[model samples]
Target: MSKTRNPNLDVIRCLAVLLVIVIHFFLNTKFYDVTINSWQLEIMVGMRTICMICVPLFMCLTGYLMHEKELSWEFYHKLWPTLSVYLQSSALIYLARIGIFRERLSLADGVLGIFSYSTAPYAWYVEMYIGLYLLIPFLNMIWQGCQTRGQHQLLVATFVILCILPTFLNIFGKMIPDYWVTLYPLAYYFSGAYIHTYETEVTQIPLRLVTLMIVLLSVMHNLNASAGRIFQWLPMNDFGSSEIYALTIVIFVGILKARLPKTIGDIAKYIAPYTFAMYLVSYIGDQLIYPIFMNWFKTESAMLAWMAVPILLIFIGSLLLAIAQKLFWQLLRVCLDKFWQKYQVL
Candidate 1:
């Protein structure tokens, strides 16, 4: 039997994807004539900055769920679908872009892109996930070897110091050695596992306090981005390293602790199954629809209302697409199951 779904994790996944959509909507698109000093600009920018947590949160969720799973045929069986989606989405996106540009599709580039180490736009998350998928067994082995919670916490802390901290220091013009590139996804991945395994009710940080810190840090990040953009000469501390990851952990913890109403839990279950497909749908919209929307709405004279319309449209449209895909997949799965049952030896 399939494992029971965790409602909290499902809620977190939906929230993360929605946050990502918000970021894509406003990150480059100009918002309604708002100057750097405007309150609206700060809110928009701050929210975008804060929502950067979504990516790391995705990594965290992966670690939480998969870190303990054995590296066996069963693991690959689960992992293959994600790999297939990445390949399919990248190809579909390339095709869509070429068609939009009215350019000839280069067959060689399309095939090569499947194997390319370089990340396609908005597809970097999948690339990182692929890397982590390969290493999860070894990672779990190491986690299993830890005799005490303190040891696991210590290892995660060491990664934060040696690998994660330098990312923050980069804002101050400090650079770490190049070899440290091997550490990342590792830092976030193991930290997620550590949080899941070692963090307990007794050790839990208060959600209220974490929420307050997220707001305060978001304001700071917003200010940093604004100053860099407005002054032109100042550095933007846009590294988004520590604060993003920190907020992600808090959010994960908060979700873990939440007891949602039955109504919300049902809704989460309904939507959660389509989230991966929604991500792919939203990404295509990000590439294709966003530019078109920007052309019509990105004027200095545009109202804040107008600025919001595209985000709403893209989000809703992606959901509709996800729903349709979910229905289609359900049908396809039924057919496949019937075929297998008829053909296979019991």
Candidate 2:
């Protein structure tokens, strides 16, 4: 099948990357002295809950685009570059941390550390993404076999029960199978396929309703965090604590319906390809750059700096890196093609 690029999807990816950066800022920032009712605390909780939509939206897009594609050498070929970035970024982060902190790095530590993003926790998405890629073919089979919308909906409903419902119940102290967590991405994969196949119109009303759900869920999360003792009857917070799935679908559909100027779509197409690169760069920023800012700025001053400076710096840096990566990949492709031609001539 030929590849077609959707400007709207690109816009979604670009937005997801930005959301990811802000979420990382919230996660790494220190709000220790801030009270539960403090503005900083509220902002942090809101950002995290809202930004949880990022990964799921990414997965949905992936499924929508690639679920039907055959898993061949081309599949791994496309994936290898992303894996390379993860490995190289992890190594660089490990080396930088050990060097700066004057920690000893043994051979086992060095080699193993390069593959594991121990110091750079945000790269956990890479591992999850690889798992999702492996399951795509199987997921495609399921998608293909479903002859009717009802059949697919039944499967999705079952997934919601087995994978999603348990997490909600767990918040209430009900224990479910631990294995259900592995199936969460599958639910999202199916969701993306459903959206694409059915071409459902997620109009303004549904978007507003989903937005309200996200707000309510975020507030519930903050209340639980601040007053867990009082809300002891609430389920244990797990994968289901937020409206991530709902918000992701809403955001994805909203983007699809949005009518933008040709100039904006053109810009989105240009920027969309670099979002993964931006994500990698931002992961490095979270590990290396943010800490320096955290220490430099003190107290509420730090929160303000976090809200302003770090985000801009990370964004600017990621944009440059993404552009550079595009150039680098282009050069590499040219070199490889030339080499293949020379060998064929020989």
RMSD of 1: 4.3
Model 1 lDDT-worst window of ten: 231-240
lDDT of candidates 1 onward, in order: 0.69, 0.69
**TM-score against native, each model:** 0.82, 0.81
lDDT assessment of candidate 2: 0.69
Candidate 1: residue pairs that collide: none
- Give candidate 1's error at residue 340 in angstroms: 12
Q: For residues 178-265, could you state the per-residue lDDT of candidate 2 as single tens digits?
A: 4675577777788788778777543434576667776687567656666412222122232332256666777788888788778888
- Model 2 compared with the native: what TM-score? 0.81
